[model samples]
Target: MSVATGNPVFETVGGDASAATVTPTGRTTAGSLADLAAQVVTNTTDAGTAKANAVSALNTANSAAAQATEALSQASKAITSSSANIAGGYAALDGSGNANVPGNMAVGASNSGARSFSIGHTGLKDWIRFQFYTGTGVAANPDFVFIGMNGTGNTDGTCALQGTAFQPLSSNTMTLGSSNNAWSGITSQTAVDVISDLNDKNIIGTLGNATYADVTAKLRVVWASISGVVYTLKSGQSGRQHIGVIAQYVAAAFKAEGLDAADFGVWCSTPKKQIVTKAVDGQKIMSIEPVYETDGKTQETQETIRYAELLSLGLFCEKLERADLEARVAALESKSTSSTAA
Candidate 1:
């Protein structure tokens, strides 16, 4: 285009010169078209880059979510395992990175570590067991009762008794007698010598025969050190020894109330005064009754986990099954996809 100065020498378009030289119609510029094409390409590239960035962000977020789910699954399994250990009737390693049952089995002197044991019913034997706490001079207490109720008199038929039984001693060492009897003097006893003495002496009356029907029996050991630590042996039994002189009261109550084995649940807790009160109410046994009848503080030294604890554990396992953590993760992934598509 040329200035409207009537200059014929200046032409605007189509190789034609006119007086209206300012006209801009019917024209094309190589430089301006090239610039426009460049702008369009730049816009397309920027949009593609933005989409790629969004995808990268989404991938990172999805990875984080997966990690979180995995962590939760691991934690869930850990909790379930711990609960199972507790329900199994042996003090488990505490969550504090320590393996030990609490209460009387608590960390003892010279015993830098805790023991772990399990209990199960074999035939007519119904019993609960705990890890044997080992230490020096823990055996033989003047006030402790160490009697083994040998229903079958084998390693399996052994049960802890709260009552005293006469044990025949060949010499200074006692031997498991062929017949059932009681011994009167066992003050401080450790786990090692307790069961051996009972087995060899055969002091328990039920030796060579089954005492209770369909029961769980465990090796028994009850001890009180001069220092006031009471160690009880956990072995198989009908769990009848769970009742001391009060056995009749417990049995009668269960029968009168029509309470069955299902009604009474076993659990171990910290021992204390009025221990029996801790037993489930109306479940039959009102509280914890020692396998042995003893005075004051010794009663406080014994603790048991309840059968209810096991019942609760079963419920927890059921929850884990329903959660189906794997399924949940899959569902979360699908949802993320749908959202990103939108």
Candidate 2:
């Protein structure tokens, strides 16, 4: 039955309210108390199912949160242990369980088996400095061996040996296994043998008939008196012998070897400019400042001749003297023959 707006439609006529009599719309709707009770039951079932699903989801979230907390606690413990180990000078385990010691790094060997420590650079220029203490009575002991490599793979470098109350030994001499050899003790026979070997390769000219004594005298002309006033250590030390030829003399003797005398003179003069006057133990003292070549532009790198070159020059000097003596002897012999014939 169609009902107009604001019109009340009474369903029950005389007895109880029947579902058929109480049609709320054009289509039949629930009108009895039993039907209303069944709808209430269905709503309650849906609500219960929703509440169960929410509890299940909450349980899963709580489980995940607990796992995260346990992981964070373990990480904190590891960090604390690592910090303690570092403070106590113990090696700490890295993420890969490898022991890493602080301040000490090892390469090419295990930490326990490492025999040497090395620092290297791949660039064209690199240098290392060994700084010593400057205070009085503090032993400024620094022992280092610098090995230089070239295409032929030979070790070449300078060694400075210093002692108490003495000057440093700054010469290029190779020491092998506790055997210390002095360059001054080089025998005349050894020098001759080296000259012979070089002559075979056309590296040096013939020495003719010059004696070792004659060459030694020539070399002596280039030697200057080293006073204690200049070197300080030579003041009271008598019978002291200085090895190594003067750079200027070497340059003069080996003009054909492309050595410039001006270059050698400049290098030799550098030491004079390096002198500093200072008071030590209530007495005025002068000392030459040490020069370190960081940029590689120093006189040592440019002007200093190698020991082999010095040896070659000594042999060549002998040859020149011998040739002059031969010419003089021949002239005298010729003059005597001419006088007798006249």
Q: RMSD, each candidate, Å?
A: 34.1, 18.5
TM-score of each: 0.21, 0.29
Pairs of residues clashing in candidate 2:
none
* Regions of candidate 1 where Cα sits further than 4 Å from its true position: 2-31, 80-342
**For model 2, what is the C-alpha lDDT against the true structure?**
0.48
Q: Model 2: residues >4 Å from true position, as ranges?
A: 1-48, 65-69, 72-76, 81-101, 106-334, 337-342
* lDDT per residue as tens, model 1, 1-342: 534454223334443222223323343422233344566799999999999999999999999999999998997766544454454455566568756544454333432233334344445453443333343555554333433344553574554544344455455575442112224235556533323455476342331135721121111100010012233336544433332222233334334444432233432233333434332432323433544346533543333323343334345434544555767988999999999999
* lDDT at position 52, candidate 2: 97
Cα lDDT listed for each candidate: 0.43, 0.48
Best by lDDT: 2
Return the TM-score for candidate 1, rounded to 2 decimals. 0.21
- Count backbone clashes in candidate 1: 59
